[model samples]
Target chain A: MNPASPAIDTESVTALLERGRTLATPVLRAAVDRLAPPMDTVAAYHFGWIDAEGNPSSGDSGKAVRPALALLSAEAAGAAPEVGIPGAVAVELVHNFSLLHDDLMDGDEQRRHRDTVWKVHGPAQAILVGDALFALANEILLELGTVDAGRATRRLTLATRKLIDGQAQDISYEHRERVTVEECLEMEGNKTGALLACAVSIGAVLGGADDRTADTLEKYGYHLGLAFQAVDDVLGIWGDPDATGKRPWSDLRQRKKSLPVVAALAAGGPASERLAQILAADAQKSETEIADFTEEEFASRAALIEEAGGREWTSQEARRQHATAIAALDEIEMPEKVRAQLVALADFVVVRER
Target chain B: MNPASPAIDTESVTALLERGRTLATPVLRAAVDRLAPPMDTVAAYHFGWIDAEGNPSSGDSGKAVRPALALLSAEAAGAAPEVGIPGAVAVELVHNFSLLHDDLMDGDEQRRHRDTVWKVHGPAQAILVGDALFALANEILLELGTVDAGRATRRLTLATRKLIDGQAQDISYEHRERVTVEECLEMEGNKTGALLACAVSIGAVLGGADDRTADTLEKYGYHLGLAFQAVDDVLGIWGDPDATGKRPWSDLRQRKKSLPVVAALAAGGPASERLAQILAADAQKSETEIADFTEEEFASRAALIEEAGGREWTSQEARRQHATAIAALDEIEMPEKVRAQLVALADFVVVRER
Candidate 1:
């Protein structure tokens, strides 16, 4: 399961995630059965291996990207990969907790080609599922054995706080008419970066790396998250639907205060004005209209993004962040090959089309 | 602040609730500032001394029942009241977390005579506020000091799981058209009773009580919760609005599947059929013509309850639980008078009105 080769590719990441699932399955499955039968249905559905009737099925449940990040970071930090799986489980649970709630908040009825957790289970049970996951995450962390309990608790608790903080900012931005690029970055940093940072930080802690090494890996993970989000924002507007499987300019339609939009908005010209007009249009505009903005409109918005330095700026920022990540890994005095894997993973994040 | 006081003696309980607020304010206020500014706004509104705009005011926020239960149980357990105040705060936070999410799921737009947190801040922020409260509860429990940290964490974590389990059952019953009175009792026992039990358990833990004493106090809290909820059901069906501040039989109109309704449904007679008819009309009905049934209807339900021996059943159950609790305390070899005061408080739970 080499992270670099396609032979060691998404399937390898899936294998790592599956390893975590196996480790966590017994405790989590039993707890869900005892405490939340309905939510167990919702969670199983969310995992994409179950139908609406709560019966098992076969489907893809994404790459388990975040969990892989956690496990690899731990291994990169010199922790035993097998022992790192529990922390990966905790991170994955937190990720899913946010996703369940986020779907409800965003009014997203569908996810991964199936009805979202809330759309099927309703908001009440969805909320409970999120809560159950949160508790289970901590419960898993507590099983780290007392020797590592305090350190694991500290890292994971702080990560949980950051994830919550990120979500708060994300919701707040929806109502705001304006936002600075800096503010948008801060929001993205907390929302997406914190968890990724924690994935790596947990690795450092479990790998029994020094505090300095742990901190370095944390910075790397954080920057990687920010860069990943920036690229995602770019793809959200213009990526091929065949590849990304998202409606074109869906971010624009929702008036989402994304990074590229923030940059274009700050540029303040005809392009910005047009962008504002499109955003100000009732959000329920038809899909045809959303994807069919005039060529002039598209060109203006593109110019605005370029003029605001969105493309050049975010690209450089991504590279710089990646560099910082790599430098941090070097400072930790890790095995060069392991550090290379982390660095390669960081690059892969920004390079993804979807 | 005396738990032994009669229910009408709101003055003491109110004062105790205020004291719990006072003790919690410094720590919670600081944490809110640091971790979750957006959620803090909603939390302030939820606390009921604030307008939607987050302006402070003098509003009767809530009865603070859970915190009072925690503080009083701690006092009865022979701990210095001040020392256990943090435990009281943790329990109160858990209560509020549940309430914030509850209002959203129930579509309860108003609470404490003001717009609910979700109504004022929207569901997203409200959800985050609940999450923040959960995180803060864990952080506050850690303040019980390093020596006590392990016990505190375990107790709080278990308590949290039980809280979610209770909520899970509640949501499940809502969708499942038919549920027995026994099942309803079990649901409330988990959702509401678990917290009450934890309130006392946490108090005992913080109070440095022996395991036997803590276990006894926990049982006392559990029965007290059942008694409290049962009395509340009585008030919901037959009590005056002027006395209870809510319309009589509101639970019936809402198709609450409360203990009485479950009993009547199990009885399966004309009364049960009529009750079913009313519930079938609308699960959220609340008009007097619909909500409050005739004396015959009330009598029928009461007879069913009596026939099923619910009142006597629960009464004897409560007493048995309390006696077990008292025996556990006796094993601790505490002073007889202190034990008497706690026993009286447990009795008051069954008899309280308004």
Candidate 2:
């Protein structure tokens, strides 16, 4: 496919995302205010609207990637953007809920250049906030103004289950010493990819696309999720600190059994032995020591990933999935411009650095 | 008010619970198989179905309180008892899910007279089991065969939110030094009471009650829950370990601001000062010294509880709520014998030991 034109700039994406937040904020705030007062402060902290002392914090809240993808998919599939707003919010809430809990379970103290909600409010309060947001997400989904709220909720429920399953796998893998490459991919697919698939699928459903197209969009999202995870795995090991807001090679230091590392270990040889030694070391090593390995080392590791077909697997898989997603959008007979924007949006996921 | 007729034996409740379990076993087992395998061992252990080795263990599973309430309410509200089987399982799963997380968050290592899921499987696995159970609960709620699955789901979602809110309040109170009596009441109302309300509401819905009647049953269950909590508060400070399975005076030792303590403190007098002294002295006392307080001291504390109107107020509140709940059931036009059974169940909440 042709690369997105240079004219598609950050200003436009930011503007679009801001508009989405503007529309969604009131709806979500109203429901949350009515439903969960004790958790309100923590929820606000997660959204970056309030600081630790319950004061305002000024900045962009989050990337808003999931919500935008959801709304754009709906619009591209020919549904009016407004109709899909609830679904967009639902997906975003689910995404954020996952984020809130993930930080706690992963024992991560910081997120987006700030102390995580758990760090600020404690895990107990943070858990309530996450659980509240998830419930509110379902509430919003029920308000999708569709006759088939049941069907919509059923899908939402299934997506959430996938999310939890993915997280379970992600956490389980951390304690595993002999994880396989296949298992790592599956974990990423569940943890990182399932919600994205749910996002597009919800959009397609709300857009009134027929069954076949909706299924294809789901595939598109599932593979996009896989690709997104693969790229994220790469970044966890080698991403620039300024861009990622994380210590470089943090995953390696933690011995996170990410796809790339799992691939290297699964190849079975010297590279595997080196990987094992690093993982099994007596104490934590400095970042420099971990990152200072030879080009031979990096290449061998990368080679293992390549041989195991992670990179090619993710890219080719993404292309095929997006093709299906695009085909689904076409079948719905969406405006060409809307379809183009959706394509640009899907493609952006593969290349996002932060 | 009737002294829980000796005829309503544990064996009958167990038999009914067993039947419900048998009916819903396949869906529950399927969900268990699909969502978690590592947890399979842990969950079986928690349920007292298997030893640590994943082989069978010998014992009763649990009291099965929520499921029994669901089935009984369904029958009382006029659905064939069999019709609400799935609802019964759904409530049981949700109940157990809450227990798994509560154990981890509270750091309690025992549940159901067995090692808690978290204690056996660790926090991470316990978290996953909780997640899996939530998914399974929603999945089972969808199978209620109530024609409008969306409504059933909305009820479940709303109930889930209330449950989370209750939990949030409970945990937040642990860190606060001077929680009010009203706040304590609200916490139990949300946490323990909401699920009871849900069981009744779901039963009514399945049993062909209109929205008003269903809401009434829910309200009744809510009152029952409050009464249940009041009794539980009394037990926390005075419960026999052989019966309650809790450490003696656990709430007092933990400085738990239960209804009686909060009320006593809020009354503000000599007794309140004495409570403050006890709380302060409790901080430095050895276990033996803490236990060495005179029987007169215990009597004085009970008198303080009475003086603050905590005991009288809670009992009156329970009676009023029970009456309101019964009135709601009456408005629903439930059968007379069934209504008597419902009344019996509500009365059991405030009176039962195990």
- Please tell me which predicted candidate would have the highest DockQ against the true structure: 2
Write model 2 residue lDDT over A200-298, tens digit each, in one string.
Answer: 777767777666766666776777677677767777766776777666555655567886677666666665666566565512556467567665655
Per-residue C-alpha lDDT of model 1 across residues A1-354, encoded as one tens digit per residue: 222221324444445556555655554455445445666777777777589887888755655656666667667766666556667777777788888888888877766657788888789878888988887777776655453544655666677778888777877787777879889989889888888888887766776766677777788888888877887788777666566656655565556788887877777776677666656663456656755776566655655666655665666666666666656666667666566566656767766777
Q: Looking at candidate 1, what is the lDDT of residue B191?
A: 75
Docking class of 1: acceptable
TM-score for model 2? 0.87
Q: What TM-score goes with each of the models? A: 0.85, 0.87
What is candidate 2's CA lDDT for residue A206? 74
- Each candidate's B-chain TM-score, in sequence, is 0.79, 0.84
Best by TM-score: 2
Give Cα distance to truth, residue A235, candidate 2, Å: 1.9
Tens-place lDDT digits, model 1, residues B1-354? 222333333444446667666766665556556656767767777777567766887776555566655666567667666666677777777788888888787666555556778887888877888888887777676644343454555566677787787777876687667897678778877776778888877866777666676666777677667767767776676656566656444555455666666766676666567666655554554554653567576555555555554455444554554445445555555556556555555555656666
